[model samples]
Target: MANIIILGAGIGGMSAAYEIRDAIGKEHAITVVGDGPVFNFTPSNPWLAVGWRKPDEIRLNVTEPLESRNIRFVPTRANKVVAEANRLDLVDGSSLNYDYLVITTGPRLAFERVPGSGPEGFTQSVCTGPHAEKAWLSYEEFLKKPGPVVVGALQGASCFGPAYEFAMILDTDLRRRKLRDRVPMTFVTSEPYIGHMGLGGIGDSKGLLESEMRQRHIKWISNARVTSVEQGKINAEQLDEQSAVLKTHELPFSYSMFIPPFAGVDAVQGIEGLTNPGGFILIDEHQCNPTFPNIFAAGVCVAIPPVEVTPVPTGAPKTGLMIESMVTAIANNLRDVLAGKPMKARATWNAMCLADMGDSGFAFIALPQIPPRNVTKAMSGKWVHLAKVAYEKYFLRKMRKGKADPIYETYVMKAFGIDRLKLEENID
Candidate 1:
């Protein structure tokens, strides 16, 4: 029987396990290794931080489902991976060998890159459950005594959605509490433009996002590198091409949330022939490591170069749908390999994003993550917010039941509302 070892139990890994479980069945052995027992729903982190979701509401114990599927569950952090030996060593002093390995450990937030960027005592983040808890308490304190607030992403940070979401959510919350006028809000980012979003403005997103921020009365500074952060001030550098002009700005704030730059998990770092300089796993379009054919990777852990280094340095953001596509491609390829058939065409992942804007949301679709394809025109409306809510509910139900279906994929594609998407040729 073939033995499969999957690393990390996050969204991409869990979805791949579920898909592979049905495809390979008892004929093959599957094992899942995770650093912890709880599976965090990252998208809901912001809501939890804002007092909309509780810790228990977003946490799911993954042991039961894997047990039912007869998949081995090892609740231990992976410390080292010997790609040549096809083995993984765990932090708990155990090791396992595998016929095939899948890595989906997700991104590592480089908190130490920026001074005082952590939650040791100052600032807060909604990137994880513990961080969200701290953020909730910090936000409560801020509510009690409103003051200046700064929210944005750090240098080389690719995940822009959460930063934008948190800013809007905070604005909505402050306005609801009649404290919007009192809070001196500033939106800061490393992007060159207000709506760059790391993907160079999907479609009309530039105009729409800029207009929205203007309406919200949030001050912004682009192409700004955060040098250091103090209790009530920020040290930044106004960067032009190949040079920087140092500038320090003091703005006392009761609360601040800054998205840190993302890198590959330490386990994947320094591994020979596996990752890029940034430590993200390097995979072909099929999600298979070109250096190690038996290894595959997905999610934020994989290296996808920036669409353009442009006006400001920014990396591409891999959303849920994009990760799902990568996982699907890897699963299908594995199935083909087991069946002794040539692998199918490499996956051409497209990005579909819906950014919720409180009362309404903006939706955008990029046919192929890399340009020169049929990138759809971005659309927005109140209905988009309703759809996003429905999607969250649908996703939670599916995960709770340990089910994987194509319905979610089709639904996401339909949400793009582009006619060309109906054609199969447009996908590959």
Candidate 2:
């Protein structure tokens, strides 16, 4: 029997554990290693930051559910990944060996890339549960003395959805509190345009997002690289299409939140042939590492190049639907390999997002995620916001029960008339 170890118990990790268990059954042992026992619904972080959702509402004790599924749970951080030896060294000094390993550790918030940014610095973050909670606290303090607000993603940042979501949510909250008049909001982003979103804008995303911002009275600065952030001030260089600095702006704000760049966690960095320079795991179409076939990766930890070059550096996003496809593909491939069959399953790499803007929201889907896609759709309305709320609850419930349901495949794909996984023989 093979000992399969899955690292990181967030969305991708938890789903992988359940899917692999269902795929392989009782023939093998499955273990999940995570730094903590709780799993935070990361997509809901923007809502949590704005007081629309509580911490408990988005956090779940994953130990019980995973254990109930007959999966071993190790609540400890990994010190290092000894890939050559097929072993992992835990922070507690214990070592665990595995026949196969799946990495879903997600990205490490590279806040240090920008000085005087992140929670420890002058700016706030909604990347994690604790970070969002901190952002809420800081936001409450700022509410007492409302001033200018700044929100956007920094250079080399990958996930741009949350940055947009939080900005709009903050606007909705302030308007509800009758404090919108007192606060001047500005969006500073590395994207060349307002809705490039790293995938070069899906459907009418640019026009839709731009229209929304205009209607809400939120000003924006595109192709911006934050040079430094001070206590109440942020310095940025606006770049032209040729990557030349066109102007430098010294903006002042009482509240600020910027999505910092992401890198692979420390545990998996600097291993030859294991990860890219940015520390993200290097996987082929099958989601298996090129150098070590026994190793696989999914979620934000997987390396994907930017869709297109921008004036300022930007990384592609790995949306929930995209990660789900990755997890499913990995599980199916593992099952095939364990059965003495060649690995054939491949993730669709599709992208879908329900970006809540408090009162309203925007939804988009990009087939195959990369440019020159077969399909792309985008829309905005209040129903999208409601759908996001429902989706959060559904996802949390799925995690709590350890169900191996292909949610995106069943619901989302059916709605859009698409498929989730493609086999090697089927790919042209």
Strongest candidate by TM-score:
2
Q: List the residue pairs that clash in candidate 1.
A: none
lDDT of 2 at 4: 99
**Candidate 2: 10-residue stretch with minimal lDDT:** 419-428
Report the lDDT tens digits of candidate 2 across residue range 312-421: 99999998788888998999999999999999998887788879898989988887688787777888899788777777777788787877466575336444344444
Tell me how candidate 1 scores on lDDT. 0.80
RMSD of each: 2.2, 2.3
Per-residue lDDT, model 2, residue 232, is 99
Per-residue lDDT value at 9 in model 2: 90
The local lDDT score (0 to 100) that residue 423 gets in candidate 1 is 30
Query: For each candidate, how many residue pairs have backbone atoms clashing (under 3 Å)?
Result: 0, 0
